[model samples]
Target: KAAYNKYLSDKRAKSTRAYIISQGIDPKRIESAIGYGEERLLNGCDGSIKCTSAQHQLNRRSEFIIVDM
Candidate 1:
């Protein structure tokens, strides 16, 4: 399950990055897609805790940070 989660996270990040570039955003301006792979949880949903599918879905996400203007 862990491996699959990481795989999904990576795939989603890659797709999102590609999408941003497809929208005409400068490729150089965009940072490489980084997947935390369950390292951070938005709703504290983790393997130890039983959460609804909806709650677990929250952890599958991507964050875009602007390092330079």
Candidate 2:
């Protein structure tokens, strides 16, 4: 699970960052592409327990968290 989680996270983060850049987000303003993997869950989904597919799907996601630099 850890390996797969990392793989997906890396893939998602890279593609997302690239897309953002291609869309004209200033490169200097961009910080870094961060892959959190399965570390942070937005909902109640865990590998140790059973969860609906929808719940698990929510865990596999990415977001751009901007902060003042």
TM-score of every model versus the real structure:
0.84, 0.81
lDDT of the structure predicted as candidate 1: 0.84
RMSD of 1: 1.4
The residue ranges of model 1 lying beyond 4 angstroms of the native Cα positions read none
Query: Would you list the clashing residue pairs of candidate 1?
Result: none
Lowest lDDT sum, 10 consecutive residues, model 1, at 31-40
Best of the candidates, lDDT: 1
In candidate 1, how many Å is residue 26 off? 1.0
What is the C-alpha lDDT profile of model 1 across 1-69, one tens digit per residue? 877777888899999999999999899998689776777779878788889999988888888999987
Task: Compose the digit string of candidate 2's lDDT tens values, residues 1-69.
Answer: 887887888889888889888999888877887777777878767687889999988887777767974
Lowest summed lDDT window (length 10), candidate 2 = 60-69
What C-alpha lDDT do the candidate models reach, one value each? 0.84, 0.82
* Model 2 per-residue lDDT at 20: 86
